[model samples]
Target: MSRRRVQTLPRASDDTVIPDPEQRHLLWARGYLYAREPSEPPHPWWRSHELGGRTLHFDPRLELSVARHGETFVAVLGIAVDLSEWLTGLGDIAEMLLDHRLRSRSAMIRALDRVCGRYIVIDGRGEHAWIQGDASCSRPVYYSTTADAYASHAHLLAAVTGSPRHPRFPDPNGLGKRTYAMPGNCTPWRDVRVLTPNTDLCLTTGEISRFFPRSRIEHRDPLLIIDHLGPLLERQLELLTREHRLLISLTAGLDSRTTLALSRSVADRVEYFCYEFPEVREGRSPEKQQDSEISRQLAERVGVTFHTVPMPYRYPEEPLLSVTRANATLFSHPALGLSHLTSGLDDRLHIRSSHFEVARRWFRRHGATQIPVDGKEMARLLTEYHGNEAPFVEEFDRFYALTDFESTEDLCDQHDLFYWEHRAGTWVPHFLAESDVAYENYTIVNARHIYEWLMSAPHRLRSNAAVQRGLITRYWPEAMEFPINGQMKEHFPAQVACAPDRASSRNWSMSGLAASLKQFLRGNSASRHFR
Candidate 1:
């Protein structure tokens, strides 16, 4: 279906309301805090309904609530939260956001520091919008030249502007899959820009600055960092527990084992479950029998309830298309179908640990000790991403320039960032529910503090997920007793990275040839082999 058809489609339900024809002339948000006056005359969709010197607009589907304090304005979405802890005695969230500092003892620069889920804080005085969201970009923040003064949703920008559909810079291969990132804040369209994680773009000065974890791994013992990571995760889960029934997913890998271990503080409060594609797993990479069984054993060990949630192997085509549309086409290939099987999960929120495995990949034994990745391999990956050798190789030099200095001490250094950006940044979002149903989802590692500690830790601590091993030892030492994915690693390894056997596409498949062609016909241009 075309973008216009999506915009014009009648309201499917109360949760999703379509804008009237006239209102859609220029992208605008209504009903939500993003409500604005109709545009002057010709571009009636956007009018001069200025709120404190700024024209407000955001995605209409957002479960947003608006509030004001003095010259500040606040709009929050995704996670339903009360900022009292982060804003205790701090008064209004808007005020704290506006001052960019707090009266409390907390650090000032990280104003939105502990706030969970996707959030946007606006300074009514200067119209300085501090927009931030989860690592998955579930609510992709977009900007275009036509609306150069501010940034909004991707679909909104595409609707109103002549945003050229071109990427100014070169990106890596398999963009929407598990391999590469959006590349230098580039999105599917050159005209529309994605506010990449760690970046905060100011509407007033148009200044974009780093807005992620300000802390790094402390100069502490590896064991100590492991201790710190466990509590840090508990705190995050504790924070989320206020509004969500934690659903800890156990799979055949280390990610789940680590997550479950760290979640010990609230084990009783959480409900553990296992999900797998038994039908789809037939020909290649079938789900291991011991995988779910181990998970059940682990849950029993934790003394928390564990249930195996069955998923469908053959997803109906139309529903898949709807999911594709809802996810903004950021998801393609085999991962798309997996979303259906797991769609029934509700009430319980998921803290996906898929991307966290990248850090651990550093330690696993790969063919001979890491061979420095060559430019030739890099070019090959890029060519595979665009699916066309000509346009891909033409800019191979640009791609090289963009990821310069990528090859460092370890093989992971060669792939970790891209993996984090693409797998976590792109694929993880698709795993989340695309419908209006309010099943909240977040990444296991989006918390800035955790990221800082992990990145700053000595490489040895993170390699082979040495930190996870330490966490498992400190939290759930018995995990060492349970065979992880049929292997008794003295230390925990990926239970099935993407944890919960999210590795549906790990191996290259001949079936991918047909799947890629279907995706192409469905409007995805990413390479066939990469998918």
Candidate 2:
């Protein structure tokens, strides 16, 4: 029952020995990839399921919960919680799928849109097949035009189709520090592309189309949104704890704090941890050091088991990097540290709050009045954060070209949709897939229902984390004892303290006029949410 003990493995003295291309390819090609044809399971560890014309070849290690009826079949690859009935797991969806009301494809999709959790569903009836990922599209479903097939990993698609690697590999040099996920539903391979979130793929015809935001994203009162989100997340955690151990990632930020607060009901079944990377210890960033310190303190006050994972000084070398690259084709230096971060942590669900960014309107530039309408403005906003890299902009242009804006442009800001469908959709899913080789993981907020609720709230409240604050206050107000993201208030001079730092009992003395003037000059008070 004690699962936190660190495991020791043999170390390679020569860290510089790079694996050959073929060996790397083999490593990348390890996971199961589904195609539109019936066939025997590819590996002994793998299993196959014939869904009409579609065949799912997946290792037994992966979760593939299937529900069947006369001619319709539905399989979910991860956890799915049905909010209406307070039901949990894939089997419930299976039973729900058997309902005559959901006999039609549109009816089934509408039902799925109401469910929450990180999962990808494959629905089949006779020869017609449709695939869709979770709300954030964190579990990516990539399709290859050249092979006329869909698989989880791009490299796996290439390996099965005998297609050559895209020139961008090793260094496509895309934006961001953690990974280089090509913008706008693009993957590392030219022939293979990611299936955008809020969209569905027709494996029968290789056609992809939008399925969510079916109506306008209506603005709701903050309390109503939080009321819905609180119980849903709490119930999900309860269901998950009943089956699997959890390793909740904590930090000084509000997102993680929200997750920690919601896990209070299931505290007995979960533990907490924070990374102490070498760079942070060496003073490259004091904020990370504060994160570790705050996380440890929170765990102590909450009476839960916690670990401080010490990371490697330099990037992990050779085999580790190779394997990471194999799974996470678009990776950066920090991904090498995943091995150390996950060491000794196995068979536990790694819960993160990264997907919560959408709730905060992550792409909304500070001091901007309107959203970016086209690819050019979108590229400028992206370049502002990522630098003026031609390649990055060009890739974004391609992503824009591939998107179905006709269906989505009217519902919400295009930037918000971009952050949802492309950035979080493509980047986070591959990161999760890469980490899967080390340990299982999922984002707590990876659900369309939750996102729809969050985005539906008033922008001012959502931007300042009114929803998260309310949830934390509702479940575990003790989490508010510390400042969020190391700051005491949402805006300077504490015009409004989002959450109190009860430990220090510190208060700001600046007047409202001063705070107001400063906020106006700053242009974008939205920046604080990301801090």
| Candidate 1: tens digits of C-alpha lDDT, residues 206-273 | 55565343332234444446646665565767777775677777886988888887777777788877
Error of 1 at 342 (Å): 8.5
Q: How many residue pairs in model 2 have overlapping backbones?
A: 0
Q: What lDDT would each prediction earn against the true structure?
A: 0.47, 0.66
Lowest lDDT sum, 10 consecutive residues, model 1, at 2-11
TM-score of every prediction relative to native: 0.66, 0.82
Model 2, CA-based lDDT: 0.66
The per-residue C-alpha lDDT of model 2 at residue 520 equals 41
Q: lDDT of candidate 1 vs native?
A: 0.47
